[model samples]
Target: MTSLPEDPSSPIGESARDTAVRRLQEAFSEGHISHEELDGRLHWALTAKTHGELVAALAALPAEKAGTTSTIAAAGGQIRRRGAWQVPRTLKVASAFGRVRLDLSRAVIEHPVIDIELQLGTGRAHITVPRDAIVDLEGLHTGWKDLRYKTRRSSRPGGPTIRISGMVGFGRLKVRHARR
Candidate 1:
C-alpha cells in the first residue's frame, strides 16, 4: 500500500486540501461547474506537488455571493439586516467552519417586505423565522455526501418558525426567501 506523502506541513496540506475540496463542492452545488469539471479540479488538487500549487488550484474556483447588492456590510463577522423594509432586499451570507445561525424571531419589521439569501461553505447552519412570514428555501450539497435539513411549522399566525438544519461536509448551502 502506498501511503500519502508525509511532511512537516502534512497537517497544513491536509487542511488546505479539505478547504479546496469544500470550495469545489460548493461551486458544484451552486451549479457553477459540472461534475466532471469538479472531479478534474479535485484530482489536480490532490496531485498538486506543493502547497502553493494546491492554493492556486483552489483559488481558481469561482466564489459564491449571497446578495445582489454591490454594497456589502459585514460587521463582527455577522451581517445584520439594515435599512427600511420596502423593496424586498436580499441578504447574502457566506461562512466556513463555525456555524452561521439566523434567528429572525426577535426582529421587528415595520415594512411588509423583505428577503433573505444564505450561503455556507462548511460546518453547520440553522435559520429560524416566523410562521406567518412568507419564505422559500433551497439547499445543495455537492460533496461526497448529501446535505440535510429539518423544518417545523408553527401554529401561531406569526409564531416563530424555522426551516432549520443543514450539515455540509466539504460543501455549502443556499437559502432564498421572499416576504410580502
Candidate 2:
C-alpha cells in the first residue's frame, strides 16, 4: 500500500516494482520461469515496501543467457522445485546424500518437450507431473540405483513431455503423475 513517489530525476522511481514485474514477465516469455513463479514474484514485487525489496524480487531470478540450463545442486540437504517455477528446456539436477524433488503439477511448460539430467550420488529424486504430461524414462541409464515411474499416460500430440536422463549411483529416482 505504501509506494514511493515518482521522481523523474532519480533513475529508481515509484515504478521500480512495476519494472521488476515487467522483467519477471520477460523472464516468463523467454521460458525462464513458470506462471506460478511469476505469480509469486509479482505478488512480492507488488507488495514490496521499499526499492530494495523490489530489487530483491528481481534478484531471485536466474541469470538469463541463451542455451543456459537451470541447475539444482543439493549436497547434504534438500532441493525442491514446486509451486510456480519457470522450468528450463534442459535442467540439471545433482544431489549427493540428499533429496531433490521436482513438482510439475502446476508448472508452466514453454516447450513441448523438456529434458532433465540428474546426477544422484547416494541420493533420491522424486518428480511429480500433471496427469496429462507424457513422461519418457528411457534416457536414464542407471547403475546400482533404483528408478521408478508411475505414469499412466503416454506421449501424445500437443501434450507436454518430460524426458528424464542421467546417472544414478546408489540412489532412487521416482516419477509419478498427479491425479486429476
Cα lDDT computed for each candidate against the true fold: 0.49, 0.77
- The C-alpha stretches of model 1 lying farther than 4 A from their native spots are 1-88, 110-113, 139-180
After best superposition, candidate 1 residue 136: deviation in angstroms? 1.1
- Clashes (backbone N, CA, C under 3 Å), per candidate, total 0, 4
Best by TM-score: 2
User: Candidate 2 clashing pairs?
Assistant: 33-86, 34-86, 36-84, 37-84
Query: Each model's RMSD to truth, in Å?
Result: 13.4, 12.3
The window of 10 residues in a row where model 2 has the poorest summed lDDT is 1-10
Off by over 4 Å in 2: 1-68, 153-157
lDDT by residue for model 1 over 73-169, one digit each (tens)?
2322543443332222344555555555565644554323344444445544555454466443443334543544334343335432222222355
Q: What's the TM-score of every candidate structure?
A: 0.35, 0.60
Clashing residue pairs in candidate 1 (N, C-alpha, C atoms within 3 angstroms)? none
Positional deviation of residue 26's Cα in model 2 after best superposition, in angstroms: 22
